[model samples]
Target: MHLHKINKVLICILLTYTVQYLMLPFPDLSAEEGVIFENPYKKTEKQTDVTQFTIYFTKKSHLIPKQDQVRLQSVADFLYRNRNFEILISAHSVEGKTNKENVLISEKRSLEVERFLLIHSVEPNQIRRLFYGNSKSPNLTKEHEALNRRVEILLQPIG
Candidate 1:
């Protein structure tokens, strides 16, 4: 009987040691081991230098240019890393277009950008969309109107 109890005690001790040995390679839950996730698109510098990014569109078109897509991707990466931040999209259209046409175009532009962000994992609640169709510009030159037809992205803290 005494020998049987000793054997049982030895078995429990050996099992405990084996489990601890197997778990030694992994990090503790509380350990600080840099970023938990690896983001290939992460930027080296802090984004504090710029809180806003813009995507320009061609005359009467809402299609996002390829270069702007890359820029927006960078912004998406930033937003992914910082969950507390929210995005504000201000969409504008060319001033010379009819008010109704500009409204539709501006809405399409904002929705397109919002969809991009949503597809990249941003929550719908974190986005606010605003459209200023045919909003008068200080300079009505073609170049200035071109600038006006864009989606302006602003990142700000939620709280």
Candidate 2:
């Protein structure tokens, strides 16, 4: 009878250890904890990538300076690579002497970018333009005023 009791204790201890070993390996992935179980068998969809470019201007200057010509050429290369993409150029001016003068400057800045792209053989049809006169920069700081005078080129993929 004493031997019988020992056997029963050993069985209980073995069962306890086995239960702990099995339970420790997997976490409780219940919905209550916001743990999601992904289906490993499912496939993923392909995605397209869009690109953007920016060019900053000097105070009261509409020309693309000699230093920036290489940068502009790189952008032209990207445009050529993605032939189906459309370019949206938003030109902005720094705080100027007058609103009218600022607006004119902004237009000239956009035209200069457009002309540069055209000269690089980018299609005119792929380009759309907008200009913002001495409107404040999204970045509001005295130093960023030079940054405010700029063009934002947004590239959108076509279907």
Candidate 3:
């Protein structure tokens, strides 16, 4: 009779411990209601006045033609038409190149784009330059990889 009572107590203790363990909160718990996500295409009232453009580069050519100045002029006019908008220029290169070379090329491309925008009357303060050499590429082909070696422009709404 005493052994049977002890067995019952042990079973109850085990069940209670199991339940408590199951009810414990996880360390990495996140509240669903507190999470916030950003939308890329959906413009808010805050973003009402920004236009963005991207320029892709190939090994063949890196410069916007000095003779054909309309391209740069158009970009400048677009920015002027927008309110509180700034441009972020990023340059990317493909993988397989040495880190040293990649960094050099990416900086060169970013600077080149910045110069073009500056010459077109875009304010130095309004432009932000970035570079990622052989780091981020959409197309991962040997031939098409060079296409990734390009400069991208992002127009952001500034408050």
Alpha-carbon error at 108 in model 3, in Å?
1.1
Can you write out model 2's per-residue Cα lDDT over 1-159, one digit (the tens) per residue? 999999999999999999997787556653342121221222322212225656667788888866456666766777888788768889988667888888889999999988998999888877888998767457556655766787787878755
Candidate 2 deviates by what RMSD?
Answer: 16.8
Name model 1 segments beyond 4 Å from true. Answer: 1-50
Q: List ranges where model 3 is wrong by over 4 Å.
A: 1-50, 65-69, 81-83
Clash pairs for candidate 2:
none
* Candidate no. 2 TM-score: 0.60
- Cα lDDT of candidate 3 equals 0.63
- Per-candidate local distance difference test: 0.74, 0.73, 0.63
RMSD of each: 14.4, 16.8, 17.2
User: Positional deviation of 144 in candidate 2, in angstroms?
Assistant: 3.2
Off-target runs (Cα >4 Å) in candidate 2 are 1-50, 139-141
Q: List the residue pairs that clash in candidate 1.
A: none
